[model samples]
Target: MSGLKKVIIPEMPPLEREMIALRIANMLEEGSYVNLGIGIPTLVSNWIEGRDIILQAEIGMLKSGPLAEEGQEEQDRINASCQFICAMPGSSYFDIETSFAMIRGGRMNVAVLGALQVSAKGDLAGWNNPSRGLGKVGNIGGSMDLAVGARKVIVAMEHFTPGGEPKIMSECSYPLTAKACVDVIVTNYAVIDVTPDGLVLKEAIPGVTAEDIQKMTAAPLKVAADFKEMEL
Candidate 1:
């Protein structure tokens, strides 16, 4: 998909996902066991490549890595997205049972996932958008398991859809993946924390005002007392 043309979205900056990816990666503490969902969350592996953070995949790989180059792809050693990857030192493998067990057993410290719509109450709906003809037969993979199983569920996605629709809403319009599962949301414009008081704006990118974010968002946002510009 390199050099791919994006004709539908022309308003947003091109490197938005990259910046958001790094921001989410930096939030992880050392030695945190993380399950990175597909899409933007997958890029986090590139950010934490050398650190001690362990990456887990529901497709039976652990201590995973970024996508392999064209000639290096190995079918047997692919990640959940079936993309070939290089295994890091001390990486391990298991059957599907134990793979999901790690997720369902609460062994994962963090689950970084992509989202479609996330409510202020932290309700998640990453799968199945009826408007897009996506939810019918089997898209719910390990997202639900990771959502409720992880100690912290951090969603990494664009702040809004390609058509300028807010993905962060007062309530999710899509089918529920998990209720109050998202703890943090990292987007192109701001970093938000889902709290008992609702979504709090933790940080905003430089030059992007809170009013800009509020206009793009569908729900009310609580500005954090320590709100500041994002370092990245």
Candidate 2:
């Protein structure tokens, strides 16, 4: 046996965060071409290493790198959401039309996205809010193309809203970007794989019992007996 040290358990939320990232990372295949949506999806690019995958940012940058050093950000260098950063070698730049064409043309293999709600049928609701209060008007952007065009789609988000409303549901009430497109849902509480039979709980985060996850979820979740907490 190797002389590696045994690890200690971490406290809740941060551990949950890492487990969410890891669950998504484990799905990435070598040489796969992927487009990452904003927020948590953006963080996955930083975690991937020694993988032959190519990362495509929707804002016209290919082979996008992590945020650059304080003084290294160039005015013209930006990511999918217009965040400034340094570009990787062999990076390509183009207009949104061309970039979106790559997504819609079926050249990409996967798309990692963040969502507000995901239904049992694999419908996604993330681009807009249907409520009355004025909030940031969410745009569909390339989400429509990417969700439908990619061979696989992964959604990373917390399990529930601050008000404790479950994001995973029997049916999404908000407008959907795509129908039956999501392949996986990674949340702070568990890693779930989407199936025709509803969400499959593949891994429950440590300290968060399986019963705890099921109780918090809006839809009936099927748990795998071999479930384990995801490792980053």
Candidate 3:
């Protein structure tokens, strides 16, 4: 929507879903208490084995581990995605009320979530896509609380929709999950930081330039001084 002209990017290989999860995992610090939202964010646990980071599930589990192997799933041990997960030693289980109390009380260090659109000012819109006609019926779940309560919020999502529309925009066209709550965005094509100055392009996939990413994003992107190729 800005005057920046769109440029066609040469077809480039994007990061695989696992790689995206790894990239986000690499950004976490030791001793972090993290909440992974459904979708790609749920994969982060698989890459964090042996790390000091602890995973939390809104469905009343803490110290959650990676996804369960085939035929290893237990009916009661699941993450927010409804996928069976392994539980770490000292894992704790409680009711949803206690789980949300931890989230709302701001005890989480980070929350990795999926998003539909993120604005230049770090606004997140993930709960509903109006085009689906779900309207108020769409599930909001714990996204709102996590976005607001986490010390940092990182969005892990694809850079574009199936129709090839950019998910990073000057303003969100969908209903917002929270305002200016996103801190970082890791996509298949690039890693960006949402800052007071603007969106900063941090790391991009090999062969893609900041200019190429800018053409795809609706908002302006400021290239970080340390910009470099994203590595898993």
Candidate 4:
């Protein structure tokens, strides 16, 4: 807060959700091997339409296709992540052992995941939001493993809950994916980077100012001097 100054929200023509996806897509690198988790993570692959990147799914496949065709989803050849997919030519399948081996062996460059809560300290909480269910809990799947194993862990999520609760906080109140594993967080409201000092507001969505974003977040955040709303 001390390093930030109040500024007007820039104008953005598109919806914040689309803006978030566009912003997250900018983080991808050529030739990087990546895994996209469900929800927002899935949308990222679609955003990277022409990028020459290799996609991996946790279920045990490499170079998976964007999304499955509308009526051509094959039950047998689906990626290990199981989001309903087709494989790219030359895409190969392996057993779960090899699949998890890629994740645990640090062969992955990045992993984009969806989170229910992420702390300012970079701890992730996507698997257990008690409010969403009773005795049964959310699935961690390979999220914990990927977050720890991958070189970069990017958390993609909407800025707030339907009830207007902030997803980024000073500390997570739910089950953790990993401590200090998240490198960045892309949300409908803002694009933030998790640093040792605090959450840095790198880009805010149009119609939302730095002050507005700070008010919405549970944790205190820092805004860059040249901060501006992301442009698609």
Off by over 4 Å in 2: 1-19, 132-138
Cα lDDT tens digits for candidate 3, 126-145: 99988889877799999999
Model 2: which ten-residue window has the lowest total lDDT? Answer: 1-10
Mark the regions of model 4 whose C-alpha exceeds 4 Å error after superposition: 1-16, 132-137
Which candidate has the top score in TM-score?
3
Model 1: per-residue Cα lDDT over 68-87, one tens digit each: 88898878898887788887
Q: Per-residue lDDT for 57-161 in model 2, tens only? A: 787878777787888878888876777877777788898888888898888899999998998878998887766344556677888889898888999898776
Evaluate all candidate structures by whole-model CA lDDT and list the values in order. 0.85, 0.79, 0.91, 0.80
Name the weakest run of 10 consecutive residues (lDDT summed) in model 1.
Answer: 1-10
Q: Each candidate's root-mean-square deviation in Å? A: 5.2, 8.2, 2.2, 4.7
Better of 2 and 3 by lDDT: 3
Candidate 1 residues lying further than 4 Å off, grouped into runs, are: 1-15, 134-136
Report the number of the highest-lDDT candidate.
3
